[model samples]
Target: MKRSVLKFGGSSVADFPKIKDISLYLKERIEKGEQLIVVVSAMGKTTDNLLASVHDLTDNPNDKDLAMLLTTGEQQTISFLSLVLNDIGVRAKPLTGYQAGIETIGKHLKSKISSIKGDLLENLFEEHDLLIVAGFQGFNKEGELTTLGRGGSDTTAVAIASAMQCPCEIYTDVTGVYSTDPRIFPEAKRWDQISFEEMMEMSALGAGVLETRSVELANNHNIPIYLGKTLSDEKGTWIVPNDQILERKAVTGVALDKEMAHITITYPSHDRQFLSDLFKLLEDAEINVDMISQIQNQDGQQFSFTFKESDEKELIRLFNALKETYPDLYFKIETTYCKVSVIGAGMRDMTGVASKIFKTLLDADITFYQVTTSEISVSYVVDEANGEKATRLLCQTFNL
Candidate 1:
């Protein structure tokens, strides 16, 4: 029998009433003879609340214990969802990451799916109409629970879909993927179809519609992802191969990333080996460095880099460690910046995209601290307050 995976975000399964509504949606699909696997996130703000509670108790908690505490949120959703479905006369079974056989490998709080033992899931399909799996968590080889950090649930849904060789449907609060965030630009247009590469770029550039890791996983496994609202019948966006998109635009979307921190470090020497060693430390720490700039003078060299705000503490810890090695190293941190980017697969074959982006920002009199470009996208760092304005102007300039 063919199988399909449907993933509901936190907002969709927020309360009992919402869970009952999702059961109805699943019941309709079961009536149509669709074998289903439902992956769900924690209830609305449940994970955040859990983290807050933990922090209130202690400033520093053990990573393994923290992951153990966090996994309970998704586990709660799985149980509640399964109970709701059974109440509606639909046969549903609930499984945690371990029970479902999602094996992972990495650090405690942020692990990646190493592989899945899918025989258990295949067997469950015989007796149940729907299998409810908790998202965002799995057990590592040491038999310890681990979470996937941000977008962990989305990664779980896509990973299961890939293993099952089925299409994945992600149900969120939005109707579909928009050219830009609708809240930032009310006139932003929603896309009916988007190429995986385009979506990947947008996701990586800070589009919140889908997680970047999920898109990368889907693309790697050649799976198509359907994104839509949980309860609405409105049409959503299809993320597929680039070849499947007939008409490609020069600029498909604008994305804004507000959670960023900029750091600049000045060293006493201009030696190349010093810079390499500093970056090697960051690499070993798994810090994702972006938008890097280097300036050198007769006195010393200064390096600037941007990274996710959430990683600021880790970065600072590494900086302190490095300071012990280079006693004269001076560093400054700025948390008031955001990155706005324009993405389009068509940019690979188009010209003047960078110029257009710069001209647009210049015409708007927006001051940018740094600029970076990939083959298919151009990114600029501006003050957090101007993020929306930059995104809107880029969207209109490209007619996205």
Candidate 2:
């Protein structure tokens, strides 16, 4: 018998009424002979509330304590969802990530899925009418609770589906993956299907279409993701294995991110040793540089490079810490910034992708400070205030 894994996001399982509606949706699927495993996120903004409590208590709360606090949100959802299913005369069992055998490594807030022993889950699905598993939280070999950090719920769902060898359907607030954010561009159309590569780049480039890690897992395990809206029967985007037919034009989507800072290090001269030393500084500070670009000075000696502003604070901290050693190597940090990216697989083989994207911005009279690209995506750094306007104009030009 074919099995299907269904995951509902915070909005999908938000309230009692929404739970009831989702329960009906599941019940009908079960009645039709589909073996079901439902993964659910924390009800509404429960996780956010818990994080708020953590923030109030400590500047950097212990990882173990935070994980314990975060797990409760999903636990509440699982228990309530199981109860709702039972109330509807369906036999359902709620399981935590531990009980379902989602094992991981790492302490506290940043754990990665190591392995999943699904025997218990298999038994429950065989014995019960439905199985409801809490998403996001997992356990390690030592039986310590762990989490996959931000956007963990989506990763949880994809991991479960991959481990169980079934397609996972994700229910969120949007009807499907849109060319652009519908909130910003009301006329944007939802895509019928998106290749995993495109989706991965889109998510990583700040599209928020799906969690990047989830897309990575799906692509790794060859699992399909059905994205749909929770509030309606609208068929959302289907993220599947890379398909030639599904590939779009030079640009498939546009994305903008507001959380960025820029840091540039200019030293006395452009030397390989200085470049290596600077990167080591970032590594020591644990700053992840995104969209980095380097240019040689006119003298062909000194060098300057730019990275996201999110790394600005740490870069400065590290520089100040080492100011005595490399006074000349110290540089300035800039924080006010945003990045807008045009992501697609077609861009790799196309000629005018970048030209068209930049032209759209020029036509809109939007001044961009920087431009960067990978084989699958191109991004521009622009003023934070014009982020949405840039995204809308690019979306219109690409007809995304």
Candidate 3:
């Protein structure tokens, strides 16, 4: 029998009706001689509601306790899906991360998956052709429940597929990946096929169609992933290796990351030791720092970096530690900003792509605060309000 792992996002299995529909869909597929493993996220907005409740009690909820609480969302989904499948006469078994033998090691809120029980899964498959597994939640060595951060379910599904050596299918609200967020611009064009490299860049830059880590893992393992709308026969995009495709667009996509914060620090003098120590501190704190810039002169040195807003509280706490030593150290931090990125593989061999990007934004009178570039990408930090405008403008300019 052909075996594959499939994942459905929250919106797809938001309620009993949708869950039943998906169960029936899988039943038909199973009857057609295919073995399946289904991964599910929390029901629609369940995780958000749980988060609101946690923050309602305290701003600094304990990570261990938070992990315990949040993982129930996916567990609820798995059991409910299992019930639906069973009621419809399908041999389905629901498994949580621990029950499914998924182990991880990292912070409770953002754990990295370390292992999966492929032999156990295949053994279970002998009796039941279908296994419904909870997504986004895994257990650490300490036996504590851990989540893979937001959009982690995508990673879970991909990891399981990698273990099984099969192509993975991810179904979400969108029919497929787009050049930009369709909600921001309804005219955003969708791609029939995208390279894993381009997909990773888009996810990291805030396409949000799939988790960045999932794409990275799939890329590393040479796994192909199919993204499409759930419960629909619509043709979707295929994410494959770069060498599989012959043509490359100059600018394939534009992404706007709204969860970014900009922080700038000014030191009294250029101190290499202090810089190294601060970076080490950030690393210890697991701060996701990006686009660091530094300037030095006879007077002092200025340092700037961007990180997700979710880490702002931890970052502030870290800064407090530095205050006792460098009382005169100055820093400016702002959360009301977003990063707009232009990405394409063709930029590696094509020239002037950056020129057209900046010129387009400048002609629109949108002032960007910071700019960073890579071989195949250029990103700019701009006011949050202008993020949509910049995305639309750039997508149009690039004909994305």
Candidate 4:
């Protein structure tokens, strides 16, 4: 029998009725003799509510305790989903990540999947039973429960597929991946298929459809992913592993982020020691910097460095460290900005891509702060308020 892993997002199981619909879908597939492993996230807004409650009680809740509390959300979801499956005459069982033998390495909030002991799942598969595993929560060697930050469900599903050596399918509110966020661009088109590299860029830059880490795992394992709507029969986006057959669309998608800050530091000399110190400080503060740039003068006597807003606090700490160390270098930090990118696998071979991208924004009179690129993508930092407009124009220009 062919085995597969099915994962449902929070929206897919947002309420009782939606759960019933998904359960029916699973039941139909099971009746047809497909061995399945189902993974599910917390119900709609459960995680948000839990976070709110934690914040209300304390400004900074303990990470381990918070993870323990949040994992319960998925437990509730999978348990209810299991009951709904049985209610429809489908024999199903719910297992928490620990019960399913999912083990992780990190401390609490940002744990990574370390290992999975599949003894229980293998036995259940031998019995020809459908296994429903809670999506995100897992235990460490210390037996402490942990959560896989935001987007954990997607990671959970893909990890399970890798462990089980089967393909995985994801069900969400949208039928499939779109050229851009459909809510922002009403005309955003859906791709019949997308490559793993392109999908990773989209997921990293704000593609809401799937978690970036999950895509990474799928790419590593050469697993195919199916994205379908929970209520519709329409075939969704297929993430393909083989690049040989993958077609390159000049503009596969557009991604945007409004929460960012920009910081730049100029120094009389491009002191390697000072730069190393700044990076170490940011690392100590656990700040993630994006789109960093550095340049030196013709004489190589002075240097300029710039980075994104998400690293503001860390940058500030680094800035102070530089002041203490050099006492002469200057730093200028600013916030209230946005970053938008046009992503496509075809960009790797496409010429004049940046020119076309900029012309679209120029036609709309959109002023951008800075621009950067990867082999497969180009991104611009712009005014925060114009984020939606920027996304719409790129979506239209590329006919995404």
Off by over 4 Å in 4: 242-246, 264-274, 284-286, 295-335
Global lDDT scores for all candidate models: 0.92, 0.82, 0.92, 0.83
What is the per-residue lDDT of model 4 for residues 1-400, given as tens digits with 9 covering 90 to 100?
8799999999889999999988888888998988899999999999999988998899757888899899989999988988988888888888999998999986588788987776678887765468899988899999999988778989999999988888999998898988888888888888888888888998887677888999999999988898988868797988987464446777789998665677677777766888788778766655667777777885434333345454565466667776977888787776667789899877777788789988999999999877878878898988888889999988878777
lDDT of 2 at 54: 81
Q: Tens digits of per-residue lDDT for model 3 on 246-347?
A: 789988899999999999999887778779878888988888889889888888999999999989889898988987788878888898899999999999
Model 2, total clashes? 8
| Model 4 / residue 393 / CA error / Å | 1.5
Q: Mind giving the per-residue lDDT tens digits that candidate 1 earns over 128-222?
A: 99999999999998899999888889999999999999999999999999999999889998899999999999988899888888999999999
**Candidate 3 deviant stretches above 4 angstroms:** none
**lDDT for position 175 in model 1:** 94
Candidate 1 collision pairs: none
All candidates: CA RMSD (Å): 1.1, 2.9, 1.2, 3.1
Question: lDDT of candidate 1?
Answer: 0.92
Error of 2 at 327 (Å): 6.5
Provide TM-scores for the models. Answer: 0.98, 0.89, 0.97, 0.89
- What are the per-residue Cα lDDT tens digits for candidate 2 across 1-400? 7798888999888899999998998888888888888989999989989988887888757778788889999999999989989988888999999888999986567787888776777877767878888989899777888888777888988998898899999888888888777888888878898899988988877777588889999999999999998857667888988763444677778888776777666666656766677678877554567766666776544434455454565566777865666667656666667888888888878788788887888888888887877888889999888899999888888877
